[model samples]
Target: MDNNKRKLTEKELKRKNDFEKISSEMQQKGYKIKNMTINIQQANFLGPLSMLPFITLTFLFYHNVNGFDLGEISLGFVVAAILFIPLAILHELIHGVTWGFFAKNHFHSIEFGFIWSSFSPYCTCSEPLEKWQYLLGTAMPTLVLGGGTAVVSVMTNQLLLFILAEYMILSGGGDFLIILKSMLYRTDKQESVYCDHPYECGFVVFEK
Candidate 1:
């Protein structure tokens, strides 16, 4: 830890304690912490791996639903691809906005920054939340931006929008991966709260 780093709040401290306890139990059960860290290499690999199925399904579904022709790449596709920068920012904003609502300090508890080495933008909530609230926040961008845009693309027969939506969904692979890990190892405890890791792309669970 850096000496100049901001001190954790009392709430954050308690959450950290709980997280450490859960981590100890998990380690005893053979879980490795390294497996949960979301670094640049993992993102590079998982992004495309997760996107293959998403792109294929979106293409097929839109084709079947609207009878839309899969057309050749055009200038419009290029434009949409360029728009991914703003879209990525919006995706992080969505996470901040949704998760901020559940935090005790609201937006003050939310931090948005980029990992320059990974070229990834992230929004993290410092406060702890119930498992369901955390899940909802994690899934909101995928559900709203990804799935919603894909639905609209199907309705409007826009290939570019479909591709864009698939890309957004793919960007969420890290979130889904963390959720999957939690589900696999989490105990059935009602007091469990999920806290987004301050310096990483995953979450830590704390149970009272």
Candidate 2:
């Protein structure tokens, strides 16, 4: 979809105006403001591609010690399919809850809903935040649920847990992209801000 061609709602306009005020101040301080966002549908299509290296290297690591078993792999996928719906819901809530903690208005600033285009639920935070704060929130689901489970799976040698971890990690493909973008972003002015876009999977960022 052509995101730029869509008209902004009144709320979005107000939000843009509010941020522009902050941008105005940064401009006065000799800093420039840039906006960033992502397309959910496009990102969804790229999800598996984004996860290629992690999944490849992981299986490669397991290949040295464990022989492949079709039955086990199939079971793992069945489990993943069963858990998909609940886990997907948990993923967005994870974003909302984590970001809510750092939001000025707390949970009031967080909104959740499903996206028919991406076939995924989205959690957005209206409140702006410091870079670390937003990054931490963005990383929590993949960290706590994805990385955390991956660790447990390796420690216990559980195929089910490994499957769950893999699913969770794959689910964060877009999160991984946004986090990388946010971290690589630079500013000479020593101030950076991030806010979840009102509806998109990614956030808007400013470096000042």
Candidate 3:
């Protein structure tokens, strides 16, 4: 039942095989690995909103013109600050696209949130992905979304844009951290088949 549409390198295939073996062995050895439900909606909204503070901070503290500032204290940086919202949204979109492409009909939901005081986005898939797929899906948003924003900001010489991009890259959190943690634990970096959890088989998380 494997979809062979995407080609995996030998090293990647080996890692996936090893992870499956470990998960199977662990289960037979009496270790429990349970799947958990993830709330994607929460991630979608919160992820974009997380950039609000940076925008607000710029307007409040850096604006040069004021009066009807919509509670904003500054306007000098308005040109660059507004991009944060869209940039955050793009972050989620990248996660969605990556998950959607790999998992086909396995999409569950999307969440946006200030999770643990950090902004992030994520998607729920039907099953755990291969380790390489999981890693790529999680990192795609940061590189494509955050990195793209940063690159464009630099090319355009927009300071506010740069700030927003940098903030999203730094504070956005989700499956990226899970991937890092999984690596450290020497466990399957990707969720095993039929698993569910925040970092389970069917989902990829992204930061704002």
Candidate 4:
């Protein structure tokens, strides 16, 4: 989408300024700053592609441990499928709730809305936070909603819950993408922090 060529509006400029102000303050406080750009197009495309392994694993687990029957699809299955919509929203809420605590503005610093271009919802924090804080917030939805659901599915042997859990995990492709990037590009510095890019789909990291 040629993110570098994209022009910033006044509001975006203000957001950038505010984000940078926080970064500058951190730098002055002896933290080194690094920025990461997330390409929405790439993220959107890769998020689903990255789910291949998870989907395969889920299928294998169901087939080997608990036989999966296609005939199981019924009215209940339809109802469970409908829950995806709310779960999508819940995914973003998880991000906000986890990250908000670390932000100076608390819940106020968290923004939730949809990205029309990608047709995806997002939850972003306006404040800078420690690297671990950002990681925890980013991973919470997958760990709790996705992983937790999977455990329940395994225990109860509910195919619907298993499918839902796998879907949730697959849907978290973008979060994992960011986490992977953070880890790959991480610095050896002892102190590090990360914040969302004011106008982009990804985050910026500060390390020292």
Candidate 5:
């Protein structure tokens, strides 16, 4: 997905104002801060767009291997639609739980809420994290619920599981965007810290 892709329309420009309140301590500690947060448009557009290949690959694999049943696919779609809300909530929780585990205050540093305007729920971690820790938390939900279920679906030949995997993977579009940006970002400095943006779909980085 990396080699020939175009740059994202949303750039992580100097968004210091967004971090002033949350990053007071990091400021005191001499961390050079930068925002990696994405806008609503990027979250709504780029996130899912990045995940298209994964979704297509999964569907094509299943279709090629097992050949979907029309009735089964219809039932799976119905069930996925009915359960999406709770599952979406779970997706955010997985981020919280995984990040919280490595946070200095544990889960106390985590917050969850919904953006009524955007129809999106968020999980935020107030503490700064090691780079790898941030990556793990960011990727956990899609790995477990999305990829794991796809494997099980293949083994069981259950179209419902595959459909559920597709929907969950789709929900991770924003997450995939965040992770991809985080990886592509470069620096000569050897150390960095990551903190989830308190109110946005992306995060901020603190570096020396």
Candidate 6:
């Protein structure tokens, strides 16, 4: 009996040590998560405005360069712009669909606004996810959107298509960074800034 008691004590000690290690790791990761969130937020403000300068520069390039066909600007640019919105919607849907494959009861949501993404793209399950599943769900959109855009851009050789892809990523804003951290967290089991309250903003909720 004494031997059995000693073994049990040893097991308990091991468990305690492991739990403490995990807890400490979580805290450190949480600090990094908060910092990343701040960076994403800061980019949200500056990135779009920075594009304005790029736009001005694009115009300057257009003007200073000779043989710029003004006719190329009209119908083709309008058609490409019209197609960009559906591509954007498909990007978000890829995120929702991939998440559903893992969490049988998964649900997702999206929000759109004039300025930013409005912060309600969500993936909720019956319980907190295994780290890998969470990471896959988070990273799905950028991969789908980015890769899709690249393939289409190559096939079409369309400059506007490439710009649309960049716009989709930039519009994702903080969420893109959140996705990156979540992907890292899968390998490292680090804490990340995930949506605590997903329904506060107007969004498209998805369910599995």
The 10-residue segment with the lowest total lDDT in model 6 = 199-208
For residues 1-208, what per-residue lDDT tens digits would candidate 2 score against the true structure? 1238667656656656665665667578765556667665677778657877777665665555454567888999998999898998998899889889988899988877775644767777777788888989988998988888877777666767777888888888898888877777666766667877654457776565
Taking all chains together, the TM-score of candidate 5 against the true structure is 0.87
Candidates sorted by TM-score, best first? 5, 4, 2, 1, 3, 6
TM-score of 3: 0.48
Best by lDDT: 5
Reference-based TM-score of each model: 0.76, 0.81, 0.48, 0.85, 0.87, 0.46
- Model 4 stretches with alpha carbons more than 4 Å out: 1-4, 7-14, 73-81
lDDT per residue as tens, model 1, 1-208: 1214546655546545655665677567654443344564676787567667776887789878876443534644676678867888999999999999988889987877775555767787877677788888988998888889999988887777777787788877777766667677746454556777655457766554
Worst 10 residues of 4 by lDDT: 71-80
The residue ranges of model 2 lying beyond 4 angstroms of the native Cα positions read 1-32, 62-68
| Backbone clash count for every predicted candidate, in the order shown | 0, 0, 26, 0, 0, 1
Candidate topping TM-score: 5
lDDT of each: 0.72, 0.75, 0.49, 0.80, 0.82, 0.45
Residue range 1-208, candidate 3, lDDT tens digits: 1326446545336445644664666577555554332345554455446545544654343333322333222442464366655666676677667766676354543333333333433343334555566567667876765566666755665555555555666445444454544454444434343322333223222111
By TM-score, the better pick of 1 and 6 is 1
Candidates 4 and 6 compared: the better one by TM-score is 4
Ordered from best to worst lDDT, the candidate numbers read 5, 4, 2, 1, 3, 6
Show pairs that collide, candidate 2: none
Q: What would the per-residue lDDT of candidate 5 be over residues 1-208, giving only the tens digit for each residue?
A: 1213323222111223434555777778777787887876768888888889999999998888888899998999999999978898999999999999999899987877776565767787778899999989999999989998988898889999999999999888888889998989998876689987654567888988
RMSD of each: 6.2, 3.4, 12.3, 2.8, 6.9, 14.5
Regions of model 1 farther than 4 Å from truth: 1-36, 68-72, 188-190
Error of 3 at 205 (Å): 15
